[model samples]
Target: MQTVPMVKQKVHQTLDTLPPQGLKELSQFLDFLKYKYQAERRTNIVALGGIWQDIPFDVTDEEVRALRRRVTDTLLSKV
Candidate 1:
């Protein structure tokens, strides 16, 4: 029930490239990105450090909620 932009899809596409292990880590990263962007009013450019290198994503508000729902549904269905 939130109004967001449509950049989250781009974030998901970026996420899809990650390995399964990376995907787990990415869930936390996505939450941080969403909070940082929405609360902190950041643009679409987040970085990933360590062996993962630098990963950047451009997420909009709408996409953020949509992707969150999508991921949650997918995960729930699997469980």
Candidate 2:
């Protein structure tokens, strides 16, 4: 298989041969490929964030603090 430098040299040679318009389209295509591979996919997660927001149940700050204190007490007891 061709090494990284060899592959890059080949790409540069190909770029050198393309017309100005072809180079513009290539740049857009490259941007698309990068986004396609690297973009974070948070659609489903963000949708789930509000799924229970409409529910009638709600935990107050005191409830959350009590739970955290219980967890910390347990950990400290073990230590």
Candidate 3:
């Protein structure tokens, strides 16, 4: 595997050879990579914490399951 410095040098060399449009495309691709990486690192529990907090603590397992099914159905229907 290439070291970090080696990777940086290679990237710079490649960037130098790219035309203006290629550089723009590379910038967009880098942004997408960063967004995808950050999104993958986030946990579902962390994402839903605030959204689920309003639900009553006494809710039963069955209710949760039913809600999940309804949500899945609704989402699948859209697809």
Candidate 4:
């Protein structure tokens, strides 16, 4: 199997053979791939700890059960 160093050497050799325009396009492509990779690696989490700090939602147990029931019904209906 090709090791990391071997692969890097091959890449460097290939880069050496590329024309100026080809090198520019390859650099841009590599940058785009890096950006895409970083974007996908991120988690979709937000710290909204105080997003509605002034608002009060005094929810009851019945409300929770009712919401769950409605959600389940909607899902089952779709299925």
The per-residue C-alpha lDDT of model 3 at residue 73 equals 100
How would you encode candidate 4's per-residue C-alpha lDDT over 24-78 as one tens digit per residue?
9999999999999999999985444586766667779999999999999999999
Candidate 1: what lDDT?
Answer: 0.80
lDDT (10s digit) by residue, model 1, range 20-77: 9999997899799898879776566546678657554566999999999999999999
- Give the distance in Å from residue 62's predicted Cα in candidate 3 to where it truly belongs: 19
> What is the per-residue lDDT of model 3 for residues 1-79, given as tens digits with 9 covering 90 to 100?
9999999999999998999999999999999999999999988743336767776567699999999999999999999
How much lDDT does each candidate structure score? 0.80, 0.87, 0.91, 0.92
Candidate 4 achieves a global lDDT of 0.92
Task: Assess every candidate by TM-score.
Answer: 0.30, 0.49, 0.55, 0.56
Model 1 bad stretches (over 4 Å): 1-17, 41-79
* TM-score, structure 3 vs. true: 0.55
Structure candidate 1, residue pairs in collision: 4-61, 4-62, 5-61, 5-62, 7-60
For candidate 3, which ten residues in a row score worst on lDDT? 44-53
Model 2 Cα lDDT, one tens digit per residue, 1-79? 9999999999999999999999999999999988987776635533324777766556699999999999999999999
Residue pairs with backbone atoms closer than 3 Å in model 2 (clashes)? none
